[model samples]
Target: MKLLQRYILGELIRVFGLLVVVLTIMLVFVGLFREATERGLGPVQILQIMPFVVPSMLPFTIPATLLLSVCVVYGRISADLEVIAAKAAGISAMRMLAPAFLFGTVLAVASFGLTNYAIPWAVANIERIVTQAVEDIFIDMLRTQHLVSEPSRGYSITVHDVQNRTLIDATFRFRTHDHHQITVRAEAARIHFDLERQQIELKLRNATYSNPGADSFGDWDGTVLHLPLPPQIHATKARHLTVADLTEKTKEAVLQDEIGQIQQANEAAMLMLTGDFHQFGGKEYSQLKGANAEAVRNQRRFKTEIHSRVAMAFSCLFFTLVGGPFSMLQARRQFITSFIMCFLPILLIYYPVMFLMVNLCKSGTLDPTWSMWVPNGILLIAGAMTLRKVMQH
Candidate 1:
């Protein structure tokens, strides 16, 4: 039994490794090309960022890769009559499948770790690195070019030229937060980087700034313009937060919601006691407006995200449960055919269903606790039926 387990486990591991490498490389190049074109990233920059990018891709690839590996390895083994020999020697099919089950359990744990910790960390770092690279390019352009236009940043600047540390015929068009346009034309400007404060200060000589809609413009001599660059490492997106972080955030949200409910109830009681029934409307309780509504929505998303992570992690086990029995039934078929048979449905049915569930979960149409596990539940039932057939045969 030990030897049989070792043999099966070794084969699965070897096949899994090969599949992971191939899939990871394919995904890496896809990402590399996309990022290179989008960010105008040089080969050196892409190479620098590649390591960080792979971790994010691995979680997506691992479960599918595991499914394929299980199919190929187990299908080939069963095709060669290895399972028949084991059964002839008084071994049950479950005993032969023990290693596969163990492998799936380990991967399930690993997937959880990857989803909760590694992917979030990688994504946050990628954002930080990309933002810093853009900032560096902006700084370089400011130092060398007479004119610089960054469409993404919504800024256009033109100068007669730069000599020593001074600019001439400098005009800058900046978009304000309120969607108003601010155009500043200066006779001369001095560009200074405040290293201590991490700010860029443009000291304008004989400048005027005007709103496009306004008839009149304000003029100043030797006006100092200071703009602070974003810090190198911005806060990670709430969705990218770890499970522990999300748990605390979820608790706070729940508390706030409970408090709001209590307050609303108290207010309703007061209104009723004071005979102000007109003040409360049917729509009032159902309608969550402003920050309160936003907070509730965000809490739902956070809860959903956390549940989805856990659900995704366990997909390793679910896929294995489904794949092992499936491969055994198709044991006599060609390995490639068996692989395709196992892989296609996962791509077609499982992924689409999983995506739909996730969207529903995020939109608050479905509860995450139940909705996230629907695909797994279906797979589990299917796997059980297949396992029964395999054992009987």
Candidate 2:
């Protein structure tokens, strides 16, 4: 029994290692290409981001790779009469499947670690690389075109020439936060990226600023302009946050909501005491309502992220649970065919249902703690039934 378990575990590991490498390499390239196309990353930036991209892709690739490995190993074994031989030796099929279960459990833990820790680290490094690349891209564009406009960011710059890192005869046009159109002309300027603040700083020499609408102009020897960073560099999305951060943020949001509710109540009581009932619909009240709504939305987002991360990680175990028995039942078929047969329904049903649940949870329509596990529950039942069949037949 010990030897049989060792043999099964060895075969599973070999197949899984091979499959995961192939799949991860394929996915890493796809990730690199997508990032390059979106961010205009050159060859050097792509190579720099490759290592960080791998960890981010692993959580996505592990479960499917494990399922295929199980299918290949178990399907081939059952087809070759190994299960029958084990049965004749008084070894139950369930006993023979113990190694798969153990392997799945390990992979599930690893998947969770990848998602909760490695991914956040990877995303940070990737963003750092992309930010530096963007700086280079920005300078390159100015060097070639002598003009760069970001309508979405409400800014544009035109330069007479870019000499190395310096801009000669640069004119900057942008909208202020208050919707004021301002233009600045400079004899020379240098740009620096402040990543911690998510802003770009322009150090201008002999600069003159004018408000076109007001027809106002002023001159200064040295002027500094700060512009918000590009949207892609600002990654506040829940997926980029670690589990501890999510939990901390969720708690903070809930506390803010509670405090806001208390303040609203107190303010309403004060207004009623002063007989200013009309103030209930004032701008302050409306702003409070908006803040409360945003807090609630943030809470939902954090909770959904926490639940979905765990659910996605545990999918490794569930995939093995379902695919192992299912493949054994389809042993007469080719291993690839068996793998396709097992993974097709998962692709079609499990993922769609899981995505629907995640969306619903994010919108506050359902509690994610249980809703995110619905797909896993379905797999558990399917695996149980399939294992029963394998045991009896």
Quote each prediction's TM-score: 0.76, 0.87
lDDT of prediction 1: 0.80
Off-target runs (Cα >4 Å) in candidate 1 are 146-239, 248-290
Off by over 4 Å in 2: 143-147, 158-171, 184-190, 203-224, 231-234, 259-285
Task: Give the per-residue lDDT digits (tens) of candidate 1, residues 1-393.
Answer: 488889999999999999999999999899888877876776777887899888778888889899888898889989999888989999888988888889998998998898788878877666656665765665557567767775655667788777655777888887766767789999988876554355557899999998876655899678987655434424456657799999898888878777777767776888799998986765554443333566687788789889888888899898988889889888954767877887787789888999899889878899999999998887899889989998999
What are the per-residue Cα lDDT tens digits for candidate 2 across 1-393? Answer: 489989999999999999999999999999999988887788998999999999999999999999999999999999999999999999998888999999999999999999889988998888889888888888989999999899999999999999877899999999987899999999999898887778889999999999979889999558778988876576557988899999999999999899888888888899899999999999887778788888898999999999999998998888989988898888854888998888999999999999999899989999998999999999999899999999999
Q: Identify the leading candidate in terms of TM-score.
A: 2
